[model samples]
Target: MRTALTEMLGVEHPLVGFNRSPAVVAAVTNAGGFGVLAASMYSPTELDAQLTWIEEQVGGRPYGVDLLVPEKFAVSDPDDLVASLRAQIPAEHFAFVDALLDEYGLPAHSAPRGEEDALDEIAAAINPAGAQALLDVTFSHRIAMVANALGPPPADLVSRAHADGVVVASLVGQRKHAVRQLEAGVDVLVAQGTEAGGHTGTVATTVLTPEVVEVADGRPVLAAGGIATGAQMAAALALGAAGVWCGSVWLSSEEDITPRPVKEKFLAAGSSDTLRSRTMTGKPARQLRSAWHDAWDRPDAPAPLPLPLQPMLAGRAWNRVHAAAAEGHPGATALDTYFIGQVVGGFTELRPAAEITREMVEDCTRRLRALGELADT
Candidate 1:
């Protein structure tokens, strides 16, 4: 509880809850843990509105924002950005998506009709200027930390965050990546492993945490991946982590934005139910195995595209899947899946985000205490 993460963020608990929902973020921060909103999921205006609401709920309490501030991203034309990016996606991929939907007995896929397009969010994250626009919004707020979820932050971004008195953090799967982050002036390192949901590497948390800690040179390192309970948090601390950065556990929280049907699937999943596949993001991300992954695995299915292209192509299809699945469409349900980790098997019911935060901290304290007594004996 008294690690660098707590001191740096001025919170009682060193836990960091990363989620896309503003309500979850506010709840965790209010419960003494730091909550980090998934900023890249929203455009600048959306990010600004969400951050504003979080501030109102927490009343100036500390929280952070996580973003995909990749140093190297595909450059594209700024004018008509969405169309430009969509143009890069091959016609074959679109045909394949249509075929997959029909094969699953679902209606043909259609792009979401709304003011807020998921594809636009992808465009914002990959475009350098768009990412800078997000940074502009983040810096304007009273954020305690700004984490680069994808890779190392640009030098200018780091310096700007530093100038704004914001703590710069990055997620690293390997020791070399940690070194690059350190050289790039990252203030915190999240040692995420293969057991994590979303984009991850091959190493397990137990192996990668200590590896990152060894090279951290005393900077605060938060162990992530497959950590959901206090016992797990204690294990992270035992491995020399300043704290634990948790993402999957939030999916089981009531405040989580994941659809109800997907939540039901998660409750029934086991440690082995998840697999790392590139079908979602073109990068290896661990997600629950569903018909979606099955479709991608067929020999005729095209190899996954890189980064923005793959996500842009799949984003709309996911929208269709979620919308239909919510209505008890069996075909959509079969194809419905989202990023989750091995710990998802442990989820039995949804709990309030604050309760989850308090329980983890309290349990971690008790476990750490018990371990200390054993060490003394």
Candidate 2:
């Protein structure tokens, strides 16, 4: 509990919870762990509203914001980036998605289709300009930190965050990436493993954590990926991590906003039930094995488009899938998958986020004490 992360983040426990729900974020922070809200899905205005609401809920407890500022993506003219990207999505990909829906026997979409709107929804998630806009909104608030969920935090973003008295953190899967982030002046490093949810590299946490810790040279390093229990947290500390960075564990928490059917799927999933596929975001991200991914993985299916386009195309389809699943469509239910880590198999119940944090910390404390007793003998 008294690691460098605890001191740096000013939290009683070094457990940092990252989630898309403001309720979950506030709950974790209020329960003595730092909370980081994922802001990549939100527009600047929407992010402002959510952060403001979180501040009201946590009542001065420290929380951070996470943005996806990938180091590289298909570039385009800022004035019409979405339009440019839309044009690049081949007809075969669109036809493939349509064919999948038809095969599922789902109801036709009743809502009007707006390609521009879909592109706009995901533009910030794939481009630096969109991330910059969100950062502009973030610096105006009383956030404790700003994390780049993907590549290194942009130099200007890091400098601005530092000037605003907020810590800058970046998630890296490779030791070399960790070195780059440290050299780029990142204040903290989240050494995430391939087993982590969402976009991740091909390194296991066991190996990646120590490698980053050694390269960190004493800077705070939080171990992430496949960590969902106190025993795992204790193991991370044993590996020299300042603490654990948890995301997927919170998805099964009571405060999470995951759809009911989707939550059921996550609870039933095993460690091997997930796959790293670009079907969701273009870049490889771990998601529950579902018919959606199965269709995309077929040898004949059109290869997924690159970043932004892949998400843009899939985002609309997912909206339909969720809507139909809510209305009792079996096929839609089969396609309802979300990003989750390998630890998802342990999520047997929907407990409160606060309770999850407290229990994990308490268990970790007990384990450490028992280890100390053994050392004394």
Candidate 3:
């Protein structure tokens, strides 16, 4: 409990739960672990309300916020920005999406009629502006950290967080990426492996964590990917990680707000059920293999569009899938899925978040003690 990560986040435990729902964030923090709310999908006003509510719910417990600010994307100019990028998304992709929906027997819904309009919706939701708004709200509260979900936090954002006394962190999949993040003045490094959920890289944790730690040079490193159990957590620490950044394991937790169908997929998934694909978010992200992934991978299927574009293309269909999955529709069930790591194989049952965190800590503590005894020999 007194590990470097605990000190950094001011939490009793080093277990940090990253989730989109405020309830899970509050619960994890209240349970003595750091809870980080994903702010990528929220509007400025919505994020403000969410952070305010979380502050009240956690009752002074430390929490964090995650924002998506990819340094490389189409838009660079501030003038035609969102409009220009949206126009670049070919109409063929939308036509392909429409055809896919018809083939899947899903009903059509009115989507953004124009390219610029669609990109505007995505930019409003995920751009730096969105993160800045969230930061305004997060700093208003007592959040302990502000993590960029993708690449390095923008220098200005880092300056803002530092000025506000919040630690800046970024997720990295490779040693070089870790070095880049540290050079960018990031305070914490989350070394997430290919086995991690959501957007991830190809390296496995066993190989990636130590390399990241080496590069970070004592900067706090949170090992992520294929780390669902306490033994895995212990292995991470043994590999020089300061803590574990856990995501997939919490999807089945009682406190998790993941939709029922997606939750079910996670519960039933084997470690091999997941594959990395850019079909959902235009980045290589680990997600449960489903008919959806298969369709996207089809030889004839159009390549997935870039970040905001890809999500925009699939957002309507994904929304429909979630809705139908809620209704227990079989077709929707076949399409039901979300980002999860290979560790999802170990997630066979739903447990309380607090209970899961406790068990992991206890098991890791016990295992660590055994390893310590082995050193005596």
Candidate number of the best TM-score: 2
lDDT of 1 by residue, 16-90 (tens): 999999999999999999999988868789899999999999988899998886666665776767777777888
lDDT of each: 0.89, 0.89, 0.83
Candidate with the greatest lDDT versus the true structure: 1
> Whose TM-score is higher: candidate 2's or candidate 3's?
2
Give lDDT tens digits, candidate 3, residues 193-221. Answer: 88999999889899999999888888899
Model 3 ranges off by over 4 Å: 76-83, 110-124
lDDT accuracy of residue 310 in candidate 1: 87
Residue 331 of model 1 has an lDDT of: 93
**TM-score for all models, in order of appearance:** 0.96, 0.97, 0.94
Cα RMSD of all models vs. native, in order, equals 1.5, 1.4, 2.3
What lDDT is obtained when candidate 2 is compared to the true structure? Answer: 0.89
Q: Clashing residue pairs, candidate 1? A: none
> Judged by lDDT against the true structure, how good is candidate 3?
0.83
Q: In order, how many clashes per candidate?
A: 0, 0, 0
Q: What is the TM-score (0 to 1) of candidate 1?
A: 0.96
Q: Candidate 1 at residue 125, lDDT? A: 68
lDDT of 1: 0.89
